[model samples]
Target chain A: MISLDIDKPRAGARVVVAMSGGVDSAVTAALVAEAGYDAVGVTLQLYDDGAASARKGACCAGQDIYDARRVADALGIPHYVLDYRTRFRESVMEPFAEAYVAGETPIPCVACNRTVKFRDLLGLARDLGADALATGHYVRRLPGPDGPELHRAVDADRDQSYFLFATSRDQLDYLRFPLGGMTKDAVRREAERRALPVAAKPDSQDICFVPNGGYARAVERLRPGAAEPGDIVDLDGRRLGGHDGTIAFTVGQRRGLKVGGTGEPLYVIRTEPEARRVVVGPRAALARSEIALGGLNWLAGAEPPCRPTPVQARIRSARPPAPATLHASADGTATVALDTPEHGVAPGQACVLYDGERVLGGGWIRRAVRP
Target chain B: MSARVYLDYNASAPVWPEAADAVDEAMRAGANASSIHAPGRAARARIEDARESVARLVGADPAGIVFTGGGTEANNQAIRCSGAERVLVSAIEHESVLSADEKAEILPVDPEGVVDPEALDRALAGDARSALVAVMLANNETGVIQPVARVAEIARRRGARVHCDAVQAAGKIPVDAASLGADSYALSAHKIGGPQGVGALVLRDPDAAGRLIHGGGQERGRRAGTENVAGVVGFGRAAGIVGERLEEFARLSALRDAMEAELHAVDPEAWTVGDRAPRLPNTSMTVMPGCESAAQVIAMDLDGIAVSAGSACSSGRIRLPYVLEAMGVDEAAAMCALRVSLGWWTTPDEIDRFVASWADLRRRTARRVA
Candidate 1:
């Protein structure tokens, strides 16, 4: 467990805090300032979608940037809004669409962190001649002999290490997570204690660029001709019905199928992009024992053992990490065998590996295998 | 600080040394301008002298200059005083004019943001009673000078008064109220090289029935309350200095043209707004397609040069440039509008620095897409 020395102040060190116009980031910046660092708040203008960002409460967009500027003004620190819309489109939005088209569910938050938040922002911090890049993420960084080590937050319910497995060692060295040692309640309490304007603001649930939770609609807007009508089929290759597009369907989605009752609830089992078809079955067919992972970024410097290394794997962000054994291949891919069968293992979903609270790494799920 | 390049002069300019000195001199006085004592008369003399200087700058009688807190208050007072059952304004006027009320009719601008005198003629010709024609002398976004004379003639023929928000035009160009035929003209101090918190409303006739702020008799009771003595002194000094530096502004205009040429060479799609119409000498608004203005501003800021997306007042909130959109530019092109304004303090080296920094930013941003 990592412990924070709250009483000791780290004086004179220049830290760049990423203020996203939320209570957590605001409190984190206030704490950093209170801790006696030369804190400079930076907000990234991720997109110029005009009213969409304001309506969705997206960080570093439209009105949120104003809130960040106000917080910085109140704190008497220099604030800046860095534009990252191009990077966001290339890194996060494109990959999200490609993943959906590949018949897998994708987690854009990981891509945002890896591309925009960490890489480009860290480069900006370096340009500003700051010592470290700080954020309000609910994850901790402990100073190790070799470098800073990443761990989950003190609040297990709010631990975000799973989404941060793609962070590189270089990025981690210049990173500081100010809210790591505090629970969500404690952070909120401190925000209230400091009288931050966003103390009671609700956390954002939907992806920032995708307004109204319409990811398929956003993709359609971005790529107008790609979303074509396709066929819905069963595992036995029997045609069921017509689908709008394979990208609109993900594993385990039930609603919007438009298929009448088969007396049993149908769940999406798989999607085939080549055939432009979605395969559905009963609830029993959704269970999977093994998942193939790709695009693996290992944060621990070396790959895990090939002979089913025992670890805890979190298939989704909200779910708890279940016991699993990961088998690494000679290629940069791994097969995770859950100790207990897990349901709704989507192909594009991320499989994050953790040892207790420390994040080992994670990769995108390529395919789920039945026992 | 690597020879600081200031391109956001439209936001708030550096106080001219003459203005700063005048402000310092005015603050040393020991009496309020409103008192009946000798010291008060001395302060009053200073206030009247500043008023004359401001009137001379805008070609108005000294009696017409009614001082207010600043440009915003000046605009608010002028726009609210149109005393009409219905208010009509150009679509490209500043937010101070646009945010008045729902009853205010926003007159549309053509593709070049030129308010069609015929349109105003039609609107005024239709509404005979209680109609106020409000159009800015120059747009804050594109710096395109409107045909206020034509608008005023058209309004007068229909028995309506014209109010021109000339805050962006007053010191940048040759502003003569008599020639423009505007009933009321608004001027702010800080848009030029003067102090903030002081401005003036030049009325065609001081006896016009309108009082935005009522208090202790000040500005001949047209605007009430104590005068911002130091700020007024600074404004007067700035107006006098700008009168002398008008030629310098022309020189800056040439530099602005050069900058535009370089930018267009880099991207032929780069277009300037109101290039065909009359505009402020030192103002140029360029549209860089597929590039966000806020991003360019940020990139320029990181490079230690200051620029803006449109107006600095609304920079933090990303919004479409309403003026450009009104001019028939699509929303996508409007988002890419970047306003780079030069001032008396802008040096040729500073312009060169901006060009180099912009080139670097363009290359770096281009790489990200590739």
Candidate 2:
């Protein structure tokens, strides 16, 4: 049986595979069915970008849904497309826009994985009589002493544990990630072996709702006039240049500043959305060794450790985890003290703490303080 | 797979053996009806015979029937190309009819799922341009039969035309387009025991039916594409055979009534939409307490039974059927709505099995919630 840690007999167990029309999830569905379990593929229509949808002038399903259905048909599994546009807007898109308008560079993917894809889908899976819900995420749910533990995927390069730290313990128990151990090449090869049509399909990049990675346009559409003209100031608060919209710039962003007269390359130290000021300075100003976090999902246990917990802290999705000490409180908040100074520790980004490969807990970066 | 009970006939009835045989025969010896050859003449005769059967089913003359791609096309033909400058469709109409034009003024419906003739009267009052009023004979979601006759009368009094979408009502109940006092009625064969992709527009003046699609002299210029000959024959065969089994619908209605009663017994709060109003005999749109329609449908499918809710979403997403919303049902209750529509072949034992499974599901759900 394609093994999941669900507490049911594999022969008759029904698993709802959240198919994303990507090669990884397609293989996950195939593996579950091969293991003698009833696998049902469910693809959520998260967004309807008219061009990608099966159009008839309604809240339509995008091309991803069609791809998922085709994969399900090939694997001989029952498939369902769920309309989640409203839920997605409420849980992920709205907060993301609000964050941008508040002068923060938000990682909406973490918001999605923690809310719509896990919290709500877990409820739906149980309601559908599924023993467990499986997804294509490249994170592992390992059996722990107390319960299931979220861990990094075996193929470190494809690991998504950094973005999945907000998954609660109970949610981790009900969730299964079958592609956690497989590399990108291995998953594509498996898809080819299973005769999946998406074997050669390219990986989806950037924010999903941001078509063609045009974040500025997406933000403008979601929050109109978010790109209003603003003043670019140095660390001393002297106006250096005028720019359009605080939404276009991010903390520690090097390019697109458009204030070329400065002799040395300048990085965005911070953005004051209320004042409509873009603070530019030397790259050193972006450094931070102390980080305050909020909304922690402490997966190791019911409560945070009383003493400081040594861990590896990851401040961004693209960055590697660095050595740090976590001081978590009972109020769903924490402080990650990095051993060495880290650069570009921006607010609204996820701060994931890891013990080796195991994800201990994580929270959203509320503020970053320089050493 | 075990023996399954298909309770989603309103979605599309199981094609009858007679219809299948007719479709097969027509496909085997395919020919263009416009040709002068013997094979062509034979095909034309078959099409005409099918048209007569469809006309008889709707109580219209054969000349009033114009075959189209499907019920959607027929609806578009009746609602869009009617030469009316203003179109007003009922709020609870099928998406195909509702999407004909975005500028269409919506006519309201009462709590009983009936279109308000008074509201239609108000909307049509003092309209300078010619107008068309489109309302369904029976809603596909709630199975509530609208007062299309009263609506037609209101339209006539206001010097406007009326079009009836009788796709869901024709087989489940007796439907006569001529008696409904409408300018045209849209019908689909698949809603009965016929094949998909075949439907007809029955108009008071058949010559007015082909305005949506323009081409050759086919369908008397009401429709101009090459005919779906096999589909047409199947539709006719199903229509001809269904008339003999009208009494079976009465029996199925009894089964449906018992099923709803069993549902209420399972969960006291559960209720069927439009229970006090006239509805299709085969359909029972029940609200399963504390459950969403999508979850209920998926669970039922897993239990080897087929039921449905929501409209025809080719994309397969489950959205709350707007019919109940139009009837002023709250969003929560609307999400809980489930439609169980029986086919002519549905047996009493199958109904019992459905009830048993439903009771088990309800118990499990209630226990979980508690």
Candidate 3:
């Protein structure tokens, strides 16, 4: 096993592992214990399964809590299950629904990482006298010339740096990612070698609060009457059909248009939530050459670059990074100029700036400009 | 195993050595009390002896003691056994009694968490239907002792039966069922340093207290299933010792008072719950402005001090305790509530360490908020 670089002596360094009852986190906890560090497992009960319907493929439920406790017992470590329902509901779930209501497709996981996991749970770890907080995130935190730096994982396909772009520099210093340098297969093998009970547990998919991928249902509950009927119109301003809710459609979406026979394929260009209208057009309309960003969070020392800097930007979690020039305005707003026109640049999705493999900064997309 | 000091006795007290020995002895005997053999007779004898000891602690007759699985079961049995069409329970009663009847009337309490006697009289007069009144002798969270005799008098005039949940008050205070005028009183073993999983419902009239678990004629057909001999032995031993240690346990109030005084000295805004009423000497619920209970608990636990929040959700996140909320504490102060309950084994050094740690936390929280 590769040795951990925690600050204190291995025998007494208290390490708190954010266990999610998954194989990855369980293995991370076992690795911490095996490295001769005192490992304390903590799992956040982020939502009430009764309040929000339990999704089959989602995690962090009652069963997951039980599984985490069993693993903690097997490892002979102290474990605590903290109730984070109110925090999660306010910070992640509520904002997610409101974002949809505002006609923006928000990434709840990014918001969760920014607020619940890093901010709240990190504070809890500090309160518990833990030297460092470790998670199963497949992202690397390596020591740089100045301090710790966030980078893409060795398993490039499973890299989660996009969702973690908003992690502040101070938090990065106290965070550890044990699965950062290993492949999923190797992690599974390590879980098997360590005899973890959740070794055979399936990977969680789907938004946890949205049961069975019922995003619209959750949104309706959060913002009552959010799914009001709207007009599905084309770029020419002719109504092709009547639809239900602007939140049901996102930019560049197809398949559920319900507008029959337009002679050519039409994609959602944008959703106007105020007017309660969804505008569809040819796929070319979805391409954007520039995007304005807001709520900028920079992972830099002292100050962020005020001048335009050339970097690669990822507009979506699954999309590859695109070459872009980030122009930082004095008033805290930023504009990204894509070297080549990128497609489906939507508002509310993160524009994460990358310098090769290192995450420089990120901001929420405010507007996509078609030039 | 470490040098951690446990101050959350209201949650569960540490098991005493004598109780452990009794449990071990009974477990070794391994006899069913229902059987007619010599071993079964020995088990029966132990169970009856435990019953007598438990009764003696609460000033009830041995024949009136009916053992149940736990305190919750005892309370449940008493509440359900009262064959009344309606139930009137104190708003501050434990969940076991509060949830016993779906439509149970809630009697309001004052700022000190004491049930108002006039409200019971008024409520009883308003409702001509036969009702069962349930009120806890002492609250688990704030340790405020309630007036059972007054409630009993009001209920007696109105032809209602009264059930007093003495789970928290039995060993900590002078609990005599005859003086309290409670038709039924509940007792738990674990709260007084016995093993868990054993408690008794002491009744004034056994016939009126209907059987909750009916199978074999155990506890004179009040509660059934073969007796938990080991658990009963531990409960009896713990109960017998608890009465003798009342004077000893009374000294915990000094430690509790010192801690509270130190807390107020650190943060003048720090407030104590149920300070105006008669309360159990060991418990103190202190609220510090702007410092959340969950964070305080974690910080104290890190410092090798064990305590609990006044009100916690199922996920263990601290919420405003309903008792405090009912007493009209604001959301901000309620969220900041911390409960520290001392017990027989809590030491002065431990109390000092806890107070220092708490003062440190208050300073840190004050700094962070600033």
lDDT of 1 at B31: 80
Tell me the whole-model lDDT of each prediction, alpha carbons only.
Answer: 0.81, 0.88, 0.87
Please compute DockQ, using alpha carbons, for every candidate against the native two-chain complex.
0.09, 0.63, 0.37
Please identify model 1 stretches exceeding 4 Å from their true place.
A1-17, A21-40, A44-77, A81-134, A138-158, A165-311, A316-320, A325-337, A341-351, A354-371, B314-318
Shift of residue A12 alpha carbon in model 2, Å:
1.0
Query: Which clashing pairs does model 1 show?
Result: none
Count clashing pairs, candidate 3.
0
Provide TM-scores for the models.
0.71, 0.96, 0.95
Candidate 3 chain B, which ten residues in sequence have the lowest lDDT sum?
B311-320
Pairs of colliding residues, candidate 3: none
Residues A201-265, candidate 3, lDDT per residue (tens digit)? 99888688788877778899899999989899999889999888888888888869999887889
Candidate 2 C-alpha lDDT tens digits along A145-244: 9988988998888899988888888888889999897898888999998789888888988888998977778889898878889899999999999888
- Show the colliding residue pairs in model 2: A1-A35, A2-A35, A228-A245, B210-B222
Residue-by-residue lDDT tens digits, candidate 3, B1-370: 3599999999889998999999999999998998899999999999989999999999998888999998889999988877888899998888788777778989999988899999988888867788889989999999998989989988998999999999998888888898889899888999999999999999987666787898998888899999999999999999999899898888888888888998999899999998889889999999988877877887787677889996344445455477888787887888788999999998989888898898988877676567
Model 3 is docked with a DockQ of 0.37
Question: Could you say which candidate leads in lDDT?
Answer: 2
